[model samples]
Target: MKKKSIVSMLVAFYLAFGVLFSSVSAKIQSEQAFDNKIVKRLKVNNIYNHIEALSKEPRVAGTEAEWKAVQYIKRQFDSYGYESELQPFTFIEYKAPTKVSVNVNGDTVAAAPFTYTPNGDVNGELDYIGLGTPDDIKGKDLTNKIALIKRGEITFGEKVINAANAGAKAVIIFNHLSGELNGTLGNVDNRFVPTIAMTKEQGDILVEKLNSGDVLSASITIAGSVIEEKTSHNVIAKKDVTHKQKDTNQVIVIGAHYDFVPTSPGANDDASGTAVTLELARVLAKVPTDTEIHFITFGAEELGLIGSNKYVDSLTDVEIDRIVGMFQLDMVGSKDAGELVMFTVDGEKNLVTDLSAAAGVRTGTPLTYGQEGRSDHVPFYYAGIPAALFIHSPTEPWYHTPEDSLDKISKEKLLETAKIVGSAAYQIARPDTPALERAKVAPKEVDYEKMTGGLK
Candidate 1:
């Protein structure tokens, strides 16, 4: 009787274990099947070719080159059978001064004009104000005087505004360090006075002279500095739900900025991202999905996220509520950069990071997330959408430099990024996946770390 009971218990345990194993295996296979739809269709050469075409020259915002890039991107989208639209918007472009001169005590001082500094020619008594804070210049008469300020504790713009409010005629901000101060006032401010930046060495000499009770007169002249309105564009292509009967009423945004700095070819600093976005759109064009997706490439991102901000601001409340996640690809294919990482504005895990992290693991390269902001994802995050930036950290040495050319791009990195992002986005859009709620489905937890460095 004892031997019969033991045999029956063993048989029951074996059957239960077999059932569990089969279920797990089926789940893995299901996920793989979905992933294959994206990875198998991704052609790295297509991505590389797009990068080569776009990065041949600098696509500076509001310039003919940028306009050409926009048209090129639109044409590519149209070729993919998606109805692409060029959303036009205007921004203020600041033209640097052609002639900037600063003379003090019959001696010339080397200086550079700040961006958006209004052209002015004035001579005034040079007064030393520490840091140019309101408290530093409190109760002091600086009428028609040039406020000599140090560069620390406040922005160059704030310092100039403080001195201007105190009736100063001009401002000179010297760096706290050795290099030249290439600073901007951020935007056009009516109260901003004519501002110029100088090295710390030159500023120290002026400070010593003023401290020694020596009277000093200074002249500042800036010419040809102009601020004008210019137009830029955002290319938008939408992929509506493939299965209306299973519509989830949710949306996902995949975006990148196509505009480059004035000097950079931007092959990695975001032509890589743009190419990946284009490729994903092509691959997913016919994929069956129940959620809507919008693939966008923005302009004037180097000009402070203007294009993305404009795009987000145009969304109505209803549209904003429908967006569940945003994946912003930037600098994803640099050969010299460190490992890939996702960055969120708040340094916390959200839906976008969770899905991508899981996708990364399934693709055989688990990802880590960090905290960062300076990308197109910022506007979407500010709009109460779950957004994350996908990029390689400890960015390449060529970032934002002329060396950011096609030779530095890595096809392997581009393919890996596309697979991860494409799968993650499709995970949300796929009909099998349930409606995504913010942090509703906890993804397999992956390692998290702080960003190692910034984009140079």
Candidate 2:
């Protein structure tokens, strides 16, 4: 009986010590948390106003409009009381063709120029190369001919390269189904010849004429395709840690691409994203936290993520590791787009997805996670940092078109996206306390189903 009493007393004392120590080590929270303050400060009208101002023109990279947009973003950051800088990088900027056409035996057909296609005028006998795969190009005499290829089975770039190797003067890729074909030669290349796209119907008629032994001659002209070195800018704003002694060197990066495809206003493609970043920076500027949050808007995303890639490449191995999480917003305010979804580069869930899922649950707009790597988040993810792209899937029909105007932006969508991201960022940035009750961040129960979708 005496030994049992001694053991029970020691166990009780140990439990009391554990509880006291945990209480002392945890952060203290008020009835309302910092995220609440952030959310309250976020106004949909401000986001909409910003979007309206930004989407007024086509902000293509390396253009006067692009530079104007960059300055505006930087100014907004400065007005929000954050130090902002423009980081410039050089790239071979490709100019969209102003004039493109194909004439078959004097019958002119409308054509679209592929990206990075050199400006040229070529006259040759048109030959059909199905799909334009390597197998299709081999053993075929395409000397001085214009290769008419179909859009399927392989990339437009591959077809162009294959035709070039076969001594073709130019390439004409037609859509596999209906409507006009719009594509790229993948990237800037010295081997790139004049490449253009046409409707499937136009290609079918040309093939029929060739197969019927009708002597066919075609003329292809692509004008205004300039390849020259140009500078693109990235706007970055930093929110310093509120508590120096308690500072966690870990940084949170929230980014969005501020550039758009040529001729597109990009209200939904990313003016929505850029507006959200600015708003978040404005709200979080006054919030006290032990973590640093960096808000950045990248340029030249439509040109294959050049801006984001450069930013990540500039970071040292140690600096890369210091980044705890990155949230990228793209196309987040379109009413016609699919619901909000978080995407990781490897299609796997990480800390970013976890916090977003929890935030979604709290905000009543639960988000789902999936896999994709076609945006600014890719570079950070590739560097082994936790990053996720916050975008609406199934994108609006106006994506990358002249129709992507301010009318497509939904204010509610912007608010919801901003709310979820702001809450999630605060979850990691709030002061670390000894317990959940005293923590500056509101304790949220993570919904795994919403985060991982019950996947492995």
Candidate 3:
């Protein structure tokens, strides 16, 4: 009887182990099957072609080129059998001054006017105010004087406004770094005085002279500055749940910026991202899914993420609550860049990174995540949505220059990014997968490196 009981226990142990192994094997197969559906349908040429078309010119926001790009994106989405919508928004566009001159004590000093600075010519005594904070100018007399300030502690706009409120006629803000300062006042403000930026070297010299009791009379002339209201757009394509009965009542956002700086063709700065978004929309058009997906190309992203901010703000409370994850692609195809990394606004791991990291391991390379907020993902993260930016770190040599053309794009990089993001997104959208509840869905924890420094 004792021998028979031992035999029965051995048999039960082997049976349980077999069942566990088979379950694990089946799970792996299921994930691969879904990934194959995305990878097999993704055409690199389609992505490359889209980039080639979009990068033919600089699609500066609020410009004719940007409008053309928006229309092209919409048409592509429509071709994929998704109903596309064009959401438009207006922004104040600042045209730089044709001439900006600053003469201090009969010596011509190098200066650049800040964006949104009104045209003005003022001649006044230069007063050195520390940082131009309200407290710094509290007990001082700055009436009709030019405030000489350093660039720190406060925004350039706020500095200018503080000085202006304190009866200053103009403002000159110098950089702490050893380069020419090119900055913006953020937006048009009636309180802003004539503001100009200078290098750290020049600013230091002025500060020393003022401290040494040398009266510096400066004349600042800014001409031909213009501010106008202009319109930009966001192209949105939606894929509703394939089976309404199995709906998870969740939404996923896949986004990229389409606008580029005036000097850059922006093939890699964002056209790579936008093209990938377009191709993904095409590939997933008919894929059966239980969650909704939104593929969006935002405008005015070059100008402080205006399009994305508007899109998020437009969402109703109900709509916002339904969004589970946002995947933002921003410079994924540059040949000269380093390994792929993900960035979150707060630098914490969330659903987007969790899903993508797992997908990355399955796709052959595990990804590292770092803290960054210079992309469209910032807006979504601020709205309490789990979002991340996908990009190659140590960015290419031509980040925002004219050299950022289509020729600099790498097909291999693009393909890798597309597979990871597509697989991750589908993991959430696939009907076979259980509905993901933020509090309940504990993704398999994977070991990954945490990057601290900003995206290089």
Local distance difference test, per candidate? 0.90, 0.85, 0.90
Off by over 4 Å in 1: 1-22, 129-141, 150-154, 175-181, 199-213, 439-456
The global Cα lDDT (0 to 1) of model 1 is 0.90
Worst 10 residues of 3 by lDDT: 447-456
| Model 1: per-residue Cα lDDT over 293-346, one tens digit each | 999999999999999999999998888988989999999999999999999999
**TM-score for each model:** 0.85, 0.70, 0.85
Pairs that collide in candidate 2 are: 25-434, 26-433, 26-434, 26-435, 27-433, 27-434, 27-438, 28-438, 29-438
lDDT of 2 at 290: 79
Cα error, residue 218 of model 3, in Å, equals 2.6
Per-residue lDDT, model 1, residue 245, is 92
lDDT string, candidate 3, 238-314, tens digits: 99899899888888999999999997899998999999999999998879998899999999999999999999999
